[model samples]
Target: MGTSINDHVDRRTFLKYGGAASISAIFAGCTDNQSTDETTNESGTDSPDSTESDGGSTSNGDDEATEFNYVTTVTPSSIDPMKGSDNLETLLLHNVYDPLLYYTDGTPPELQSWLATNYSVSDDGQTYTFELRSDATFHNGDQVTASDVKYSVQRMMDMQNGFSWMWEGVLSPENVEVVDEKTVRMTTNDVYAPFLYTLPFLYIVNQDQVEANANSDGQFGEHGDYGTEWLEANDAGSGPYQLASRERKREIVLEKNDDWWREFPHGQDGYEVVSAEMVQESATAAGRMREGAEMADQWLPLQTYNDLANEDGVRVHAKATFNPFYVYMHTQREPLDDVHVRRAISYAFDYDAALTDVMSGDSDHLQGPLPGAMWSHTDDLETYGQDLEQAQAELEQSEYTASDIDLEYTYVSGLTVEQNMGLLLQSNIQELGGSLSVNKAPWSNITEMTTSKESTPDMLAVYLSFSYADPDTFLYPAWHSNSHGSWTSASWYQNDEVDDLLTEARRTVSQEDRVPIYEQAQRIIAEDAPALFVMNQATRNALSTDVQGFKDNGITGYRQTFHRYYQG
Candidate 1:
């Protein structure tokens, strides 16, 4: 055993060269679901018809009284799984991919084993071993093994080739152990309470595909470069779906793993997937969802959220995913370096006012790092508000007068949600005392600003998903100095107290006991105002009325197959 305790859409390092960008290209883009006589003879099944759904549909429950299979897709900026950072990974990707263990359908720690039939840890918490599901098979029809598990995770631990740092300090390569081809073990340098929750997101890609481009000269194929060349643009998951195609912003397709051996929805019985596909960031994904062109869908962003929230025909399913929106002052830089000035700015604008007047009250005011959905959420915590007198007084306390306090904010454009947010903030600051400028840049440019050391903007609005539901979601990665260790720590905040609070929280096992500590940590980060922790909104989703059986599925696992699909 080693040590213990570690842990989305998040990263876009892989740059695919070409692909189609139309919604119509869907279904047609799904290339190979055919059971050729060769493999079909081995597996003993006829070719699954792409046009007809397994016409044998059923209403599994009250919510399932409709006609269709499950319809969901993980929407990561990239599906490599190792670089996962956004709603896509936690909400969707894990469904199609498997790690050692995962949250059983409705229970938090039912810890139903997937690729791994069972797992165990040493008494010292130094090492962990997982027994692979002997019957498991990858999308490529390859056997699942311990090497694939070690290779996939270790690659993330190797930073030069992978941004394993995104896992923060939870994963340490010094701890991984391979116990033969069927058993794998992991040891941690420290105790980690959220270990199981973190594993589901670490999808196991096939070792062979990872080494597809290895140099014939013998130096490039090994897992040693730390997964550098292997996972660049590969897929090896043994789940309900497999990578059918990926054409950068065009479309990504996942033909169902007909050989998938998992039990049916709710584990009642077993079933085979006919086919499943995920539309990419291309213009098509949105079009299909907006036009109601299909029964299955994935990755609907702001527009989809708004449309379905109000539309009558679409059955929108939205839960506030783990993301916190915020605005920050660059303390390491100019004017913002002064606390009084920062406080003055904080007081200058009223967030409640902004949410009401602009956000249509869809969002809430800033307080703690965790959202209302988190167990630690506390309206009782100290919060910021607009105070003309206090704001002016703070401004007066600082060297800058009204005219001297000139500030600029950078934001990503092309979204009404974004426009209203920035404009409201601009108005808030303008009414208080300082002169404020808002710059709306493209998503690419805005992302660049945060990652660069020399060019990080003085002030900007960023929405980050706290991937897992644990308090560490807000603590470790958001506040720890080590969090800033990676280029993604755009806030550049340094607080020892905050870091300690998070570290302590992660070490403890009781979630109930973890609340007070997290609450106090929230108070600390709020006062520091690394980013004015803004509001949390329900990440929205919608299904046609015919779509059922998925209504009550909380923020855990996603089953887009025939869990409750049937004819209404």
Candidate 2:
């Protein structure tokens, strides 16, 4: 990672930098073209549910049955799905688990009868209908039922875990009721357009698991819900992969689930995972994938990936993804609490300079909340310019003078690249008649800053990668006022308008309808300036020359597809 190109940053100098506030650059690149109008995610409402070619990409006469099998340093933030989970984990789960409906190649999102083989919706929007897939069974061989869907959705709500935002509006206790052993319906209080995109993440539950940890009452909520210490270390799902073993800071192994529904592309299609395990976060794993290391199957530290790209026995792929990077202003914190102060803070950073000079033109400067991947992304909404004139004018309009405040920007230490962006930001803030102090926390400590009270700081420079291809990817808990985003809303800018817009966006069943709402909310967010939206990243998963068939479904970085992945 310390290695450098001829561009001002030398290998030693790059390594010498500490926190996120050491350098600044300008954002200089853009995606080659807009993503297809009717994007093909391969499944869900999109079209013909079954589409499969051999999993691997082959050019030579040799026929490869499988491809794109590799590992990375990232680990699941959580498996609960109802909490702060990892984007990488979601990608893994997408393959092993099936939602009520899913996005497939080039078609309208369609509901898959994964567990619910068939289903219907009530005449009123309040009730949703589903038919049980009699054959669909969990990894443990337990048949899934309508009650399981009811229980899982309810359990998510009852736990009040971080992920509840996904369904806060879609499923309510008063509305979702099962009609019989084979049917279930979800009726909404009102017309919600985005209801379909919402259910795909509603993974079914096993009554047995709920009963295993239930409270004194016959039900499984009260005290035994998820986010508790139990689910964090265990695994039992109707998925293709099962947790094999794990050691914190080391490696977590996931072996194939033979009982995994056994459906093509769904259950490994009856074919056994001749390979028993998938490893996570091991340096040994990284070493085996680096360039010149024949055994090197996969590696991290983008620099290493770049090196392996041209080497034999490995492969590399890079593409633009939907990850948005930004700097947050704690609405509850000082200076940030003021709209003008927030705007002034936003003006302090030279985002373009940071991306260009520091990142060496590898990123796209952010213009608004809904980046280009979405249908309604607008260039007019971008706000990352150094407008000293407007910033000063805004500062003058505010009641307090610059002398009354001091600012602190806290960042994670592992962000070798983004840390430099922070430094440039610190410099910009100083130019606006303010004091900007920088602080760094290690991964073990920095991560807590997102929620835990002890980790709360005045300001946080954060990055969000959403190229993994899901509407809820960044919208739900992150911006939904009642969710985790609220916990991080230091500026405390709570507008019923923005909230309602997000609500409408999620409830709208059609993305064309949802885009406007998403755009509206994004516009308000930009104006309020709670966060200084930076640039979107172009994800590059560099492997040796041999890796292939890795398709990016959009929410970049964290969501690299690996199912049926293999080495040459």
Candidate 3:
């Protein structure tokens, strides 16, 4: 039986890469169905087409009454679902595309059928058969078929980019068989435990639409880049909305799909357009909010959130998330390579101060990689709190004295909160008789430096959320030797014992049996101190008071469907 959605298991207690405080008065004086005349874009440009009096356009009794403006810091690398990697890209793809299995925020959280109406798993747990919904159709008015599923999977494998790692050892082109027009069968190489959880990422694209837009000189033969070039600005899905226009890092506009298969969840009185403006600067986002500009309806950072809390017509909603922030201590480096030194650095830093002062109490101190929400999370693990004495003692045991070594602490530039946290760490490390230099760089530079161990700094602060809900998603990618050199596992810490344990746990079919193995692995990694377990972020967003039906789910965080929200 699937877990009940209402199971409030408080196993332990956390942003994507983001900070906080209280203002209960923010929600006061909120009026229903308030309409704004003009909507401001993130670049401080006025969207002339967005001046509809009803907040959205309507045609022939079509119930298009609202237009929700959402602001984000990140930009989509690509509109193609298979190529999406970051939160912004995934957010756009989720609304524009439909996966076979849709993840829902139901009590006991479950995978709800989307394109596929029903599915069956073989007794061996290796074969999965799915029956597509007959009524489902792509945005271009093409009927969805089993062949489309096969084509999509084959295309993803052929491209070998983005989420290709999902099917690495589990599935191949030969395993995806179209039994009939509406039925498809998928066979895996092994008993993959997270197969169902990973399905939501496999968005089914229209085979015909993609082929029609293929370029002759594209990367893929015949398929011609698999319509990637065309998909960069267009969408090929049958979701609630369709792409109208995209300005790369500036803004993306999605218009309501009037011929959508499923009715709007909240009925006909929903938004007809969703505008996602990219506001990279938190200060700019805050300024827009303070001025009561209709630039964004939802999704703002803690810095902007705090600034808007006291402002009238703004409502602040915060929810604990599974994403955890960490300070990766590169084990390949000189002083950080020593376990004692890593432990000393972990103990010396003040976790509470970082969460309270730096983060503004918008997060919880996390002891390990796994968040408290996961079933395999072990709460008994030692949480290395602030202890200067223990830190000094651990440093004394290291081969090199603190005074003899200088360390570089790197953080993503433009993030004021992260800069503050880095400075705090520098101060903490300085007290241990070491000279620490704080380096600020763009997120792209940090990602580039992590590609090689030689370029990786002594300590790197990063905010990472799980791609899937499984423990392997957290452990293997962040700790396994295979993940070394990747930004996710910048520490370059490798242990044969940990690798074996993670392998065993992943291969184990029974969740009950896998718990102990994962628990053991967690303990081993925690003791190694390759990364400082900082905190699990609490996603804090400031929404306009008139916004309604916006429920924050821990798993999806801010990447929610605009259809779920409506102007009150």
lDDT of 3 by residue, 147-201 (tens): 9999989998898655666676678878999999999999988887778777777
Per candidate, the number of residue pairs that clash is 36, 80, 10
lDDT of 2 by residue, 507-535 (tens): 56666677677777778878878777787
Task: Give the range of the ten consecutive residues with the poorest summed lDDT in model 2.
Answer: 7-16
Candidate 3 worst ten-residue window by lDDT: 5-14
TM-scores of the candidates in the order shown: 0.74, 0.77, 0.83
C-alpha lDDT of residue 90 in model 2: 56
For TM-score, the strongest prediction is: 3
Q: How well does model 2 score by local distance difference test?
A: 0.52
**lDDT for residue 41 in candidate 3, whole number 0-100:** 39
lDDT of each: 0.54, 0.52, 0.71
Question: How well is each residue in 407-474 modelled by candidate 1, as lDDT tens digits?
Answer: 77776543344455666677777777566787866544554465555677777766654434356655
Candidate 3 Cα misplacement greater than 4 A, ranges = 1-65, 214-224, 290-303, 360-362, 396-405, 442-458, 482-486, 557-559
Q: Rank order by TM-score, top first? A: 3, 2, 1
